[model samples]
Target: MLPSAIVSMTEFPLNSNGKIDRKALPAPEFTMERCDKVAYVAPQSPAHITTCEILASLLGVDKVGLDDNFFVLGGHSILAMKAIMAIKQAIGIDINIVNLFEAQSVRELCVLVDAELLRKQLEETEEFEEEGVF
Candidate 1:
């Protein structure tokens, strides 16, 4: 498993007995360092914006950008399930957890969601044609 945070120090804090002081260690700072790899891209479409909001809420972050990585944002398997469920509830489209693992970005997920929406629309249109509703 990847470490949640890493701290670099010149020397370890020691107790009177010369043992390392665990409590004296500084708290690990959690930063969005992973996001530095990619330029921050704002969400342009409604679907993208909504997806970012859901992820940000789930991850307890203030904001989520289109290119933000889910795992880097502290999402795990359990959280992945929650995210998929949340998306289904919010957008009315089911997303496979496997796709989340493969994509892991709001922009990529919106692409999948858009494709599923189009597919559902096509299915409804076909059913209407069959029933001569059009």
Candidate 2:
């Protein structure tokens, strides 16, 4: 999951001794757009369903929609890596971390997963053909 809100600090908070002060740091503000008009859209395929389930579980949400923004839902970089690993184990596809950052929604991630799966299948087929195993 990505950060929903980012706080920029001009200088590090320091204590009287000139040490970094954790307590003096300002709290980050997190704001997400809430819309009552937005309807929940179900997963369209097995991959989509799996992706949603993984995200929901990782993000500790009751349910995740295809259009839901991961960062807005409290996703962070560490959780993103965890989600990627879970996705790889569940779907047998390696998802690049950068790709995950770029595609922050379940729908977009599913598309990347599908494309990766297709590429893997093609590669396997090509290898098999070269070896005359099929």
Candidate 3:
């Protein structure tokens, strides 16, 4: 059966042994008032599109919006790393993990990616000039 609701915990409850306390976990509230669907927002730019695609593929979702938050969509550190690696391999840009966490949305991530790409290009240009290649 499909899940009825999604619960978000700020932090996992811990037992005296420092392990996750399953018994202390809050019960899931089965409420019909919750909406499971997210309104889709189309990506605006190439960077936005690429980020959205990467996030959707990593998260196993059919579609992802530019404004959709990664963590809110069930993304974790491992998934984040996978997503970043995929983005790097696909677009040749390395997005910092801290920046990804700070900017959780695809739109925000695209901006960061663009800046990083530009910075890399500028650095390469400087190095080439120093070598008298340009």
Tens-digit lDDT track of model 3 for 17-104 = 9999999998887542232355678987787788888898887777788777787776788988998999899889888888888885
| lDDT (10s digit) by residue, model 2, range 1-134 | 23455779899989999999989888986433442134678898898899899999998877788888776676778989999999999999999988888985768988998999899999999999999999
As a TM-score, model 2 comes out at 0.72
Candidate of highest lDDT:
1
Ranked by TM-score, the better of candidates 2 and 3 is 2
Question: After superposition, which runs of candidate 3 have C-alpha atoms over 4 Å from their true positions?
Answer: 1-39
User: Which 10-residue window in model 2 sums to the lowest lDDT?
Assistant: 30-39
Please rank every candidate by lDDT, starting with the best. 1, 2, 3
lDDT of each: 0.85, 0.83, 0.81
Candidate 1 per-residue C-alpha lDDT over 1-134 given as tens digits, one digit per residue, 9 for 90 to 100: 46778899999999999999999999997676765777778888777788888888999988888888888878888888999999889888888899998885767888998898888899999999999999
TM-score of each prediction: 0.79, 0.72, 0.68
RMSD of 3: 7.3
